[model samples]
Target chain A: MVFLSFINNLINGVSLGSVYAIIALGYTMVYGIAKMLNFAHGDIIMVGAYVCFFMVSSFGLNPVFGILSAILVCTVLGILIEQLAYKPLRQANSLAVLITAIGVSYFLQNAAQLMWTSNPRIFPAIFGNGGLQLAGGQLMVPYKTLVTIGVCVIIMVGLILFTGKTRTGKAMRACSEDKEAAQLMGINVNRTISITFAIGSALAAVAGVLLCASYPKLIPTTGSMPGIKAFTAAVFGGIGSIPGAFLGGILLGVIEIFSSAYLSTELANAIVFLVLIVVLLVKPTGLLGKRTSEKV
Target chain B: MLKVEGINVYYDKIHAIKDVSFQVKEGEIVALIGANGAGKTTTLHTVTGLIRPKSGAITYFPEREANLYDLTKMPPHKMVEMGLAHVPEGRRIFLQMTVLENLEMGAFCKGKATKEDLDRVFARFPRLQERKKQVAGTLSGGEQQMLAMGRALMSHPKLLMLDEPSMGLSPILVEQIFDIIVELHRSGTTILLVEQNAEMALQIADRAYVLESGRVVMEGVGSELAASEEIRKAYLGG
Candidate 1:
């Protein structure tokens, strides 16, 4: 019975980790290309969740359409934010850009509160309460858990291939290394950055939907804690690396789940943060980050 | 053919280029030799549209005729499209990418690099071909310089501008790089060479200009400047 419970917790941890992985992918990619920490990225998740919620519940659309619309809306919002908020400040210092990003984050959170109100809405279970029974009903894996894990895996593989093979992907990698050189090569730096924001925000939509589905709590602040945790996850794995974000997210989720289960429910977050601090102290660059040295 | 009619440029408050005027005619090797901080790189940058000039005009005649375009108004990438390739200072090839990838990026303006283009560059630098799969950062300094030149050649540029191509290389490697520059010039590419090594630059250049404190102090035929007593004292070492 103990073993079965452990297996259940492991699955739960992975499911939560999968959502964090998606969110971290958004953070890492934006940070890598734009060289800015976009604090407003979390609020994008809130907006996406609201869009998906209204589409399915109020508009009575199919769940697939709701998800698609959410992605589209978030993608457009991401591009707009980058152009209006980030582009003008491209030549500004890092501190200024960081402050602007924080301001944008607060604007999004307050806008969401005004639109959706503070009361938490129970998100509709689009996947329904279903599961696979194994070991003669001794263990069951929920469909939501299975789907979340599967989607995360697919997105990871797709991202790897896209970045590895495509022209635009190579251009993005080049821009990340040296924007001025990339521009000199006729790579259109601004367009590449806009495309990055679009991709990151689209992933944010998927993360938002999955997060609400698993937790079933739809609120303006629903994305905040998860967002911070995923950002931590990105740092844990190596902020600019895609694979790092995945590893960090999974480890963070597992740690959080295990700590809450075995230690204390109230201290799960604190434990997770403590583990992060220890890891950073040892590695400095996170698990998979490259140690970059300046060339003379 | 290119013409710069007294262009002035500033980097913030510092005047980097003061009424700098020089021209590269068809099939000519033009060298701009100057000491460090004398604005040789800035002159090349202004011509390539990487930096906007405070005043004056830069005109490019693709056909060497009445058709001329104002380079100051054009974007840097558009300058590449007009068959102008700049091998920037410090050999700024993408270090994380492989040699092949760096060359491919050089041909970015051309949509895709043809097999012929690859062969052409490979023929020029067989060393790059051998190490095409190697990450650029792992290559030796000399190899990186060769790769930078090979990358610029991939654009099939009409006019190739090289900035400090010999920086940080051994004397033997510098000779090899200069030899490659002369060879590239022989194959119908107008060249704009910027160097602090005045002796070697003057030897290969058809016409050369000397810059001091952002001003063109002297201009004459390569051999005459090389033979001049003042030139020998100021640039060629007394």
Candidate 2:
């Protein structure tokens, strides 16, 4: 039983951890380029989940099809968010933009609540009847977990390839390092930033569809808890490091699941925060982050 | 192939460049020499579209346009697309990206850097090829400067504007950089260079302009400026 449960927790952790990773990519990429923390980022994910739900119920589409729809639509939403919410106030101080981001986040969350109501609408399942039983006290690993992990892996790999191998990816990296310099080099910084938001929100949309499929619930505020958790994972791994965000998310997810299972479920979220505080205390730059001393 | 006429630039009433004017031929390395805060950089920035002058005419080629471009009104990104490459005061490479990534960014204006272009850039800066996979921030200052130059070259610009490329470098690296600049000019790249090191700049430039207090104090051939009393007195540690 202990072995079985441990395996179950680990499997569950990977799936949940992936959600954090995908969501954190949105935060990390935007921060990398804009030097901004899009506080409204989580709500973007919630909006994605809601859109997926709408696609399925209103259009009688498969959750997988809904996932793609969510991704395409969220990409537009992400770009719009940048063009409208962030771009207009870019020249303003980070504090001003920060406040605006929070305003946007809250606005989206509350707006979704107003439109969708506080109730958690059921999401149609895509994994089919689950559970592959293993030896000894009969541990069962759900098929949904496998699918979730697969999707996260695929997206993560895709992201890494895009950033490492593509021209636009290189442009994004350039903008992140030095926006003024990137601009001077002929890269369209504004367009690159918009593209970044689009890609990031798309990742969040994928995460949303997965979450809805796995949990079978919907709410405008659903992305709230996971948003905070993913933020924690990002900080724990190293905020602007894309690969670091993924790694951090997985570790945090595993830590969270085991703590909940072996200890108290109520202590789960607290443990994640505690780890973040501890990591911050030990390494202010997070696990993979490097210390940057300001050069005049 | 470029000319500036009576250009005036300001930053909220703090006049930066006052009636500054200069010119460069189709294939020439023109040096702009000045002391700190002499508005040399401001003039360069204005030309590069980072700052626009309040009133001036910057005519390129045969000087046929009706009114000179309000460079100040143009964005930095547009400047590059127009075939101008500016290497800023600091070597601003993407620190998190690799050497390869930095070079790729430089070629962003051209869309895709052909294999021949990559090879040419690599040949010009072999050190970059050796450290293509290395992260930019880890590179030494001299290497970073080389990377900056290499990155600029990747844009395949008709005009290259460099600001204080020798600000901080060992004497050997400084000499090497000057040698490279001379070679770059010989290879037919038009250069607009600003330097505090008047002696080195004069030695490398075909012609030179001496700026003081936001105005052009003197202009002459490089060798002639190198021999002038004013150039010897203020710069060259005379």
Candidate 3:
């Protein structure tokens, strides 16, 4: 029974890992353009989940409509964060923005708790529970988990294509390389930065809705740890590298899920943090990061 | 035509440009010449809106008061929109973007670049067309210089101010670059050029301002300045 449970946990870990990867992409993309870790990003996700919960419970909206609402709201919130928090101090020290992000994160979390209450509100069912038969034995894989994994993959692919294929994508790449130069080219750099924030927040919203479906609870502070975890994924993948962020998030999720069964949950979180410390020491730029030498 | 007047600029506590003034008549090339610390760069920067002046007024003619802009105080992007484009020293191209992307970026002020405009730029610097898709940082020194000028041109400015366009090029490329400047001037683009190359600067500049320690010590027609004993011994090395 124990061996079967371990095998079952392994499958569950992969599905959960997909959700983390999807969320981490938001952190990675925003970080790539804005060049700062958005400490409030996870809260954006939490806000997303709450939006869905409110829509379904109060307005009796379809789950899909609620999901779309969550995305739209998160996108607006993300752009607002940039305009209000990031834009003014763009040329200031990175520390200023990092601190602002932390303040925003806390502010959003507290505001959320105040608005939605500190108590965990139940998330209405998006998928009923059932396990599919695997390897001749039934694995307790919820229908929600499969939907989450599928959604994450689709979003990831869409992001990759958008960033690589379009002219606007080319402009974004230009801005990331050098903001001053991009402006000289006549590109409305501010608009591009805002768009980047919008996309990143929308991705976080998707992850939030999926997470709510899996966990079935919503709280304002819910995005906090996941925020840190997604940031970790971004760093692990190579903070500035997009594909790296996605890979890092999925890897982190799997590690956390399996370790929870192998070791105590507290130990698991601690171990994950320890791994980050090690990765930082070993490769300061993370797994796929390119080295940028200082120019004279 | 562009005119500058009575502009005093300070960096921290040090005066960088003191009551310096000059002009570039239509289709003319004017050079701002000085030793390393002569505030030549600052003069260009002031005109380009990189740094604000401490005191004094700068007004253009005919529309002097009407087209009034404290050029030193405007934002960098806004300055470009006002028909003043600057090509900074050391060829500051977007290191991560391709050459084509860098060139395309120049036209951001213009609503979308036409192929003809790109062709004109490419005609001016054929090497840029060859490496349009290559990342800018990897370009050779001469290629980067061309790219820097090319980018400034993309904005279609009436007055193009360039700081040290030939700073680190081979003698051959420097001459080629000078030739291009003369060609550009002949084609009707007004230029405010700053340089340490005294000899070459005078050869093409219609007018010149010689600066020393942040103040203009000499100003005249390029031919007259080239013949001065002070310019001959100290700057022209004649």
Q: Considering every candidate listed, which one attains the maximal lDDT?
A: 1
lDDT by residue (A74-178, candidate 1, tens digit) is: 999999999999999999999999999999998898888887798988888887898999889999998989999999998888888888777888888899998
Off by over 4 Å in 2: A292-296, B62-70
- Clashing pairs for predicted structure model 2, backbone only: B1-B24, B1-B25, B52-B72
Across residues B71-136, which tens digit of lDDT does each residue of candidate 1 receive? 999888777788888999988988988999999989988888788999999999999999999989
Interface RMSD of 3: 2.8
lDDT ranking from best candidate downward: 1, 2, 3
Q: For every candidate structure, what is the RMSD over all alpha carbons to the true structure, in angstroms?
A: 1.3, 2.5, 3.2
| Residue B178 lDDT (model 3) | 94
Cα RMSD for predicted model 1: 1.3
Q: What is the DockQ of candidate 1?
A: 0.67
Q: Is 1 or 3 the stronger prediction by DockQ?
A: 1
Q: Per-prediction DockQ, in order?
A: 0.67, 0.68, 0.40
Q: Select the stronger candidate by TM-score from 2 and 3.
A: 2
Q: What is the lDDT of residue B222 in candidate 3?
A: 93
Chain B TM-scores per candidate, in order, are 0.98, 0.94, 0.94
